[model samples]
Target: MSSLELCYPQLLNWSCRGLECLHSEAVLLYTLFSSIAVITVALNLLVIISISHFRHLQTPPNLLLLALAISDLLVGLLVMPVESMRIIESCWLLGDIMCSLSFFLSFTLTSASVGIIVLISIDRIVAINYPLQYINVCVCRVCVCVCVCWGCSFLYNGLILKDNFSLRDRHCNGECIVVNNYVSEAVDIVVTFIGPCSVIIVLYTRVFTVVVSQTHSMNSHITAGTGCKVKATKSQRKAAGILGIVILVYLFTFCPYYYPSLAGENNLQVLGIVTWLLYLNSCLNQLMYVFLYPWFKKAIKFIATLKILEQNSSHANML
Candidate 1:
């Protein structure tokens, strides 16, 4: 028996169960998880394609957005499908090899997504607090930072791949479970939760402070008839607001999942729900960009308009 069987013996109870009883419960949970995962994947793919195909949406900050979208898209397309299939099969039929691969890929992408968000918060902080400096630094620094995030997350996940595959249970599903080792648990907490959350808190704190300071400065300048200062202040506040929302979404979607997993509980039902919500975060990113950022909305609209015009021109040529 594996650690899960030791913890939750009821899951494998051979005495008080029928096939119907097991099938009904499994189907209900599978439907709920699979539907949500599929929708989340679809939405993330849409966001990735939209951003990738549109040159107008390819700024430095939006480059971070593209990275995030791609990471989440992988989680949806690769990780969630395996998870959903596991839920339906009621066992990890893919055996140990695919299990380790899936678990490592899922955790790496999830960590990288969080890291990218932290980088975005830092970028906004710099942009708001040091506008002239930001313009001078150029896109090369952004690329380097993104590459660092990817490399760090990849290495972190690679370190734990052995523990991920060491489980003795063939019935364990494809979802990421905490390894039964102190070092692995500690690393998971630091890499997946603590480090990212620390970055978020620090960067957002500085960002809010800068925004407040700029707002006050702009108000004073406005009193002296400086229109540019007012515009600058408004832009700073808008960026700050968007960052705040991103932080909230990250906390709400991710913390619940990591918190319980780190606690070493084997509550599969709770784990399933938290995992689904975390996947939903990928879909929510697009919605956040559409609702919070005016530039994103305008760029999307512009792309739509151009697409329409191109279609019309093609129709005219055919005629």
Candidate 2:
């Protein structure tokens, strides 16, 4: 075989074997992943700026979104590029410490995203069932919850990857992989996937039920300015429906990611597809927002035209 096919030709005996990193297939994958990373950064950055810039948009729910966007942004900015390089190279060229830190960072950010999804679900329940109270809600409490969510994510991933920090378990100098025993994998599924997902499913179920009831109530009480109430009701219903779809899409992407754990297999033959599927969700969330939320559309317009740089732009009416 050609020396070009080896990761390190001089150290061929220990180096991992793979096609050249600049090969057509590798370049194509890198391009695709790089595009994904860029889109994820751009979209989530918009969300961050929109929520932070517009005073009218600084609601508690949007705060949650800001938190989610921050997590996703980190994934796109820090995690995706590294993972793409790993895929293109098929070798761990960054050394042992980076291999450990990079995977830990990825896991932490992914876990935070999941936690925020659950919080979003809970937020929707309040928005639908207690609309009056939800509008008057304080962002500080939501900030606390977001903090706890991130803190827990850091703690959780640390525990999960505790063994990885030590170099004793590394199978090869050129390979970077995180291996969890059957029990650890089971625990991860329960904590990150099963538990949070169950809460999301139940919370969304209640949200939909309330939305249905509100729709029926509004339909029956026809009066002057009834259309006004209907207008508000329509937005709520649309938001609830869109959020449901977002949750469904999230489940679709995340389900296969846990398949290896559920099946008790460590080998990630499914890694390339499932890992990126999970990555895709980070970008998908912003896409859904762009599709459904006019505020986001307006935000994009203001941002793209550099209208955001004008004086007192945060006071601009997004609604």
Candidate 3:
């Protein structure tokens, strides 16, 4: 091999080759990836602030959203930049420990984001199907669910990637790729994608059906006592519809990323495109909220203008 082929001259053939990109193409790639990272962080940060600072926005559904925002924020702030450098440079300059930790965080945040979506689906289901009991169940139980989602994500990814931390069999100098055994890959696909997506689809289908039936029923005259119930149900339906869009976008982006695992092909070239698409989902989510929810727009205005800094601003009626 030529001297330039090796990422580390000392490692010879074992070291991965350095990437060679045309100068113009390299500049474009950096610009694209950097823009994505910035947008992801900024948008998710708006969500985090919107939910955390506003008392009216701290409802159970929004609490789940906050957790999701945090995960996405980490994806932007941590995973995207590192993964971009690793992919574009085509070599790992960082040591093995950093590589392992980066992969661990990527997997954990991804799983947590999916878990949060599942929780949101469940929350919407309960709000629609059991509107009367939603208040009782959501107030404390939903918080517990959010906590469990994050905790499980961390522990589960740790187990799945433990070997990468301890063994160097699949890696060499200047190589940051992670290798997973068949069983582990299968389990990850099932747990992170298959099972959660199935649940979300099923729940959303039911939610849509119920919403349509409810909308049809709304045409009929309603008694005064039932007016409050009707209003709440309408609000719940709207939230469900918006969340459904988010889920659809998420699945669209993530399914491609997992295709290699499903097809039993594990190669870097296949991963690079799909993984960036998956990261793009983070930016899309906030855009969806902006388009679908007026409250988010109002919140953004207040945040941008520093109106939220005022005393008692948390109590401002956002909804």
Each candidate's number of clashing pairs is 0, 0, 0
List, residue by residue over 1-319, the lDDT tens digit for candidate 2: 1244556667767667654545777778888999999999999999999999999999888899899999999999999999888766766788878888998999999999999999999988888788888878898999999999999999999988888887524465677888667678778999989998899999888888888888899989878878888898887788789879988988998999988767865564478678889988999999899988889999999999999999999999998
Candidate 1 global TM-score:
0.81
Sequence-dependent TM-score of model 2: 0.92
The parts of candidate 2 lying over 4 Å away from their true place are 1-22, 167-169, 265-269
Model 1 global lDDT (CA atoms, 0 to 1): 0.72
Work out how many backbone clashes candidate 2 has.
0
Backbone clash pairs for candidate 3 read none
Global lDDT scores for all candidate models: 0.72, 0.87, 0.86
Candidate 1 structure quality by residue, lDDT tens digits, 84-154: 76434434545567867877887788889988998898889878877888888666877899999999989
lDDT of model number 3: 0.86
Per residue, candidate 3 scores C-alpha lDDT tens digits across 190-222 of 999999999999999999998878877775756
lDDT of 1 at 201: 88
Query: So what's the TM-score on candidate 3?
Result: 0.93
